[model samples]
Target: MHYALAPRTFLFSHYFATGLRIATGIIGLTFLAYFIADLPTAVAVAMGALCTSLMDMPSPLRHKFNEMLAGVLLCSVVALLVSLSSQVEWLLFTVIVLVSFLASMMVVYGRKAMPLQFAALFVMMLSSEAPSTPLQALRHAALFFAGGAGYMAYAMVVVWRLQRRLKQQVLAEALYELANYTNMKAGCYDIEAGLPAQMEKLVRGQSVLAERQQASRDLILRGRPTPDEEILVQVHYAMFDLYELVLATHTDYELLRQHFAKGTILPLLGDLIGKAARDIEAVAYAMTRNQPSRSNVDYGPELAALDAVLRDVPVGEGEDYDAQAALRATANKIRDVIAMIGRLHAATQASHGALPLVPHTDMTPFLTQQRYSLGILVSNLRWSSPVFRFALRVAMAILAGLVLSRWLPYTSHGYWTALTIAVILKPSFSLTKQRRADRLIGTLIGCMITAVILHFVHTPAILIGFLFVATAAAPAFLSIKYRYTAVAASVQALLLIGLTVPHGGSGVSERLLDTLLGTLIATFFSYVLPSWEYHNLPRLVDAVLDANRKYIDAAADLLLKRTGDDVQYRVSRKRFMDSLATLSAALGRMLDEPADKRRAPDELNRFTVQNYLLVAHMAALRLLMQRYAENLPAREVETALEAMFAEVRASLGAAHEAVPAQAAGQSTWIAAWPGWAPLQRRLRLLQRDAAQVAQSRTAIGAALGRD
Candidate 1:
């Protein structure tokens, strides 16, 4: 179980976030009641939260408006169906459940404006509560829509501010990562292990920057292209290439380390690596600020140093030769990268910040197969036993609520009990635990808030108004922080306490009793007959290893210049990512379990980071090879292909440990290198990918278990 530290900053942020949410929640809740005031408040509260939960935080304003409009229209139609089918309550409930599931499935599949989650929750709200009248149900639906709309407006303003803050924050973190890379040049070489995190963060940063660019694109469109955009893209591409070079360097380093005079060449290579890192940092900083003042200053200096180093570097005949030529080549790549950065800087400054357009054919042909396969993988997973788990959890919550209502003095108090349990009954174990703890605490806080209000003012309508404010604002406030579960529990507490006014009882006694009951029931059901066993990490391990095998096969085929059948390649890539995601989640769950319960004979399953990079490198190599293969000269390519085939066969034999050292150890690409087709230029790319996959498979097998 993960421990929740009472970090002072998080606590402070939670409170401020709560305040904002409460304010919007009140307005939203009140707006829902504005048109139709006959409905029970419970249904409205659940639907409101559901709406906020399903909304994408970064969706465009216009897109949100359209989605919300569609949601309202859909909900309205469903309300009509409920009115007609009210005579058969059981039938309606079944229909509601079915509708809810299908709509949610659609959301997951379509990834469209409409969120199936809202529709499902809306159905649940209506069917579970069994609203007394058509007007009452309609009123509840209206309030739910109003609450969601109000919070959405608030989210728009708040998130816009947050996005701006993130830019500076992430940029600072990127610079720090750059510094770390520069400082680690002399450490053990392990590119797949070492540089993946840095590159991943850069990829995420670029995505965020792209969002920011879109935000300002309209205004900047009339102006010339911004040098910043070009510089940023150039930076992005350069980082991509740098990451690849890092991987190649790691391989080269390992090879050299095995036989070279480390005392002679390692020092010089390390210095070159350090210098390249410095150049990267300078370019990153310049790109982040979109400033050119330091470009010529930094770029020119790196190029001068790189050129001097290359001129002095010594060349050797073989792969094992301990010459500095490879180091010089690496340095030259950095200098050429700097030249590209300079071009971007000039282009950006000249174009008023517009992006430089590259005319290219659609990557859709190559990437579509992979993308579609991934979609199917996600869809298949969603339709698995997890769906049953979610449904069962919902049923259990409803049962617990029914049981609690029997003991409560009032029905409204029981509603509170049930809602509380549902709030904390998350789909997974750790989430359930975290929400349970937060639920208990938030309930106490809500009780205190109501008690304090009761002491100062006793009017029922005033109490209702306060509860409304608390409920509506909870979602908006929780929107920004990880304090959502707590905020939600507190909101429910306030609403339930206000509901007690009609029954004429002091809410404190009922509040504590209901909270205790809800917590106990939720905790019991969560552990009893658990839906998934995190301890059995072997299941995930098995899947990952199988996927790794397929990935190896895909690399081998691609390396052989076999792009004729792309389906296997597509399947392999898709399986690789899905398995990776599964492994990541499984590892997390395994780590969460008690020490004895954790599976996987050893920590061998912890190679997720390395495996992920190896997969990426494989994909990149395949793409490069495909591009070259598609343009090869027929006759020349045929002869070169035969030669490459022989080397591949030798490597494969050696991979199985079935080839003699004399034959397998021969140089594979010496003569096949510059001879035949355009595709031959990228044949090395394919070979590198295949080599990494084979090497990684061996390393992982050694680390985990030999198959």
Candidate 2:
């Protein structure tokens, strides 16, 4: 019963809800137009609504409005141009090439421009399906704008109404991912699990967590929160602090496994951490439903049992001392995690006592900044630019597809071929290959489903219902999973054509064939001027190094009491995380490429893991200082921290430079005080991780031919 509820929580997620809302607006507007006016008007309005909906991603209310507005205007203009040129074959072909290149080039502006780019291309394909006179073309473009504007207005109202709820949903999503990350971290405590595989999964999980945290930042920190939204703001802050604590839990898991191989302590620790993950997941579930957390799992017994077992373990010298200290440190961090979870639940229940003060500094720097300037696009118009190469690749594929469609028999709906090309071909070969597979599989399944429905069910009402479901599911599943999106999109397109056109269902076979053709063309062109991930390794590695350096500098300042957790530190940390995620994602793509194209796979993997460990160690060091400041030698600790920071800096320096074998010998200062054993151990771990990072960097540089 407990496991059953978990699936249900995800099934009714915010993504699905947003999909339903969009479906409601689009179908509602289309049907009303069809009933009150005519089918043509309804079709125009639906096209406009659908194109504009592509831009309706999760963002701030103001940014959402502006983005949707841009979509409406750009799509409308593209429709008008396509309509006007459809009468002349050569002119239409020329327009297709120019439009494809320009639209694909919009990627220079980053992720935010992707939907707008697709919207323009989508409208062009739709408008080209029917030729129009200059005056009718004007009318069609106007209706398209009207429909987009209407949907935009409708969407803004819905967002405004559910603004707070949206914030909660995004925050809950981050928490849920954090919970998953914690569960994965628990696997490290299992003696049977392979540490290398576990670390790989953890790195991938970090990439996902970074993305979720950014989304939370964009939504929760966009503008000043009102009095009612203060609790959410506080929860948002607490969630990140909790994430740092989780990172700080990274210690010598292998060492612990070796020491506790025959005992029950390892399993006990894993069980405790796993339960904490579930507790977090429960809170996230409550947040999604806007209900107070009703957590039933009591950690008291588990904590007491773990404490009793740890009390029985002998605290001897050397390895025994290190193992015991690592275990105790992990247990203490788990306690901190549990306490943080309580605070999170309290915030949700509106208990505001002792909430952390929200940062008053400008939060804009923490949020990702996208510059929408023509200079960026123009600057990318070079052979070396990935965007330029991608644009050319897309345009060429479309042109080849067009020529093949003209030559092929029974190709009445050739525009589908072009549409498939536009959708499938991407800048990277990995994405193009994935999309090609999804498109073919999804189209095959959707066509079969639609055929079965059309053959058996003759009720117009049932067909319309299917149409609504498909329309809503397409956009909803787009971000969740592309294969699902492709299936729903295929069904929606076929149904709309069948209902509005003379013989839409009859083209199911043609749809499959065209998808195959598009896939083939896209696959062929993917190899043309492809921007391999290996080519970017130098820059990505440098970015990881630079971000880690800045992050360590900020962390050191905070540890030494020179700064608070100000915006600067937060920004540095966020940037570091972002860079790590970028590098990790790039490496993933590189691995997916052909084996010959992959560079430094082992070295890059090690570099990423070591960098991750370096950050975690620094976080642990900070927590150690906070916990033992009163008992330790303050001056000696500060001096040692400075030395440790220098060691890390030297290790992370340019790959060509020589790094010291040992920058700060721990025995010089750490041996003077046994009371600071925990801090001393953490410092030694930091130095070890830094040295490993340097080694990985040198290996990566050698593989890339940079050294």
Candidate 3:
């Protein structure tokens, strides 16, 4: 048995891999038989099928694929009609282009963008130099449908096995975040920076899982993971617990900082805070791994000990951490979150479908602020003036594409240039830059893969099989966050090479030429659009100011404890968070901009990070102030609020300009307002923190360093 363990193990693993290959081979053989009468015709149909599958790999990929399919189908139908009427090439091309553009645009700006993408490709196919009789065109359309349907079936088979795995990953991430949040409150250090991003991913994963489940039902639902799906639904509830805990942490930290600034507590708490941050980071790392979570490390007794130490420690002010009862209230808030996590975890084990829609918390503010409706086509286009924007971007892209096309050795390179322009003319600079980089890298890698495949397997059947594997792997890879980079890279490679296969490229050099020209055009248009520069310093500064205003206004309302206005306050805070996210995105775009086009913001990205942190601090302060405000008289709090507001305005104005630090420990806002020592001291701390945040500018340095 020990003679050659590695070789034996490899062979064992190979058996399973080989089995899958055989199964796939059988599927391909069956499809091959249907179109055996004409090998070239069969090959064309197979190629189209493969492209559809590959394009459908990512969850979001469907929107693009659907648009392309719809567009293609529509164009094909129209072209068939026209072929029956007339055979003039110029007239056919013109009609196809007009119809396709209108159809694609209808879907793109409509509720779904998937159909529009298909429309574009269909239009291209119809208008291609290859002419066909009406019957022939109709046959091509039927082949396209057949290929599409075959791949759809293929997806159902592969995704059924994957659904369970994806469900487990999603649940584990949600649970880990929940656990980490609870641990942090017990004076432990734990930070999961990826938690927020993971939330977005999990939401998307759930959507996909739902779609797959529906597809499975249509195919033969007996094989689907019904029990696992139920558990996954319970897991979504567990996620609510995690979100609440994080929000509590934000508010708690604000209170903690204020308590410390009062100069009443020892600095011993800082080490514990740092430890909590470390613990959270560790938990985040664990969740990302495929392995099971480590057994719970119960720190209940340790927390009790820490609580005892805090109670015994003498304060100059002789006030407890919970003296104003703010800390205790925050602790209770965190406990509520912990209880929810515990209950949800139990429910997940029990296997449940939908839970009772208990109004545990109001998310109206978060939703209203973050999600913007694109509206119905006619209405949205009327508002956005889509035709005008489209023409402007198209013209810019065409200009850039033409410039790159001139340098390409092949005249056909212009088509890729047009495609490059289309991809680059998105709504935002950051998106354009990301897509450009992704497209270039994907194209390069895909072309190399195609070259290797052509050398080894020249036949259409083998090529189609290869495409199936690529397509199946795409969605699985794109399911996780870290894999997105590779997903984009893989997708670009596949799409470019897939499209070129029918054209019968001369060699690798020609393929490379097309890719390079496409990349050049895409990258060039991304920078030269002369649109609103996302990373403009003034815009960044303005965004920071706006976010600050929203945060302050929300914090004030929360502190006042106006229950009916919760939705408005949450909405305002959500807007503030969005603004911070926008600023971060802008910083990324600035890094990608051409050197000459990239202008440094006045204070740089330091201002952006500071503003972000400031908003978070304000959130925490709102939570703390509301709890603490409960202990004081209503009149006293109102008076203090007015004084604090004045101080914030003055401090903000002074810090608005970049200036050298002065050690006078002067007050920008505090001096202007006459107030009690406690109120003045609290306001002073905010000014100090805001100034420190604004003055620190490491983000810009980090961005430049990456270059």
Question: TM-score of every model?
Answer: 0.57, 0.96, 0.59
- lDDT by residue for model 2 over 1-707, one digit each (tens)? 11212567755567877888889989988887789789899999989999999998788888898899999988998999999998998999899899999999998887889888888888988898877899989989998998898899999999999889889888888888999999999899898899988998899899998998898988898878877677788888878888988898876787888888887888888888888889888888888887878667788887899999988988689999898888888899889988888877877787544466674778888786657888889999999999999999999998898889878778556688888988898777788888889988999999988887777777778889999999888887787678888999988988876776636656888888998998899888998989999999999989989998998889888888898555677788888878989999999988878888999888998889999998788778777777766657777788778878888787777455766766544565456555478877787788788888888888888888952
- Deviation in angstroms for 299 in model 1? 10
- Residue 246 alpha-carbon offset, candidate 2, angstroms: 0.6
Q: Which ten residues in a row have the lowest lDDT in candidate 2?
A: 1-10
Evaluate candidate 1 by giving its C-alpha RMSD to the native, one decimal.
9.3
RMSD, each candidate, Å?
9.3, 2.2, 10.5
The residue-by-residue lDDT of candidate 1 on 1-707, one tens digit each, is: 00012242222232344344444544455446544554445446445544553453334344444555555556545655554455565665555545444443333333342343444444444434454466765665565565556555555556545433323223323433443443354343333334444433333332333333332322222223244444333333334334444433332344434544434445444554565555555554453444542443434453555466556555555653333433543344444434543553354245433544433333232221211134543554443555445545555555555555676665445545655566666556766676678778777766676566666767766766776566544543443333553555464555554555444346665766777788888888776545454434446655765776666667566556566555566557556656666666555555564565444423433345445545544544443344345444445544544554454444433432433222122233333432232234334433444344344434544544432
Candidate 1 TM-score, C-alpha based: 0.57
Count: clashes, candidate 1: 16
lDDT of 3 at 58: 22
lDDT at residue 246 of model 3 (Cα atoms)? 45
lDDT per model vs. reference: 0.48, 0.84, 0.46
Q: In model 1, how large is the Cα lDDT of residue 37?
A: 58
lDDT of 1: 0.48
Higher TM-score: candidate 1 or 2?
2
Ranking by lDDT: 2, 1, 3
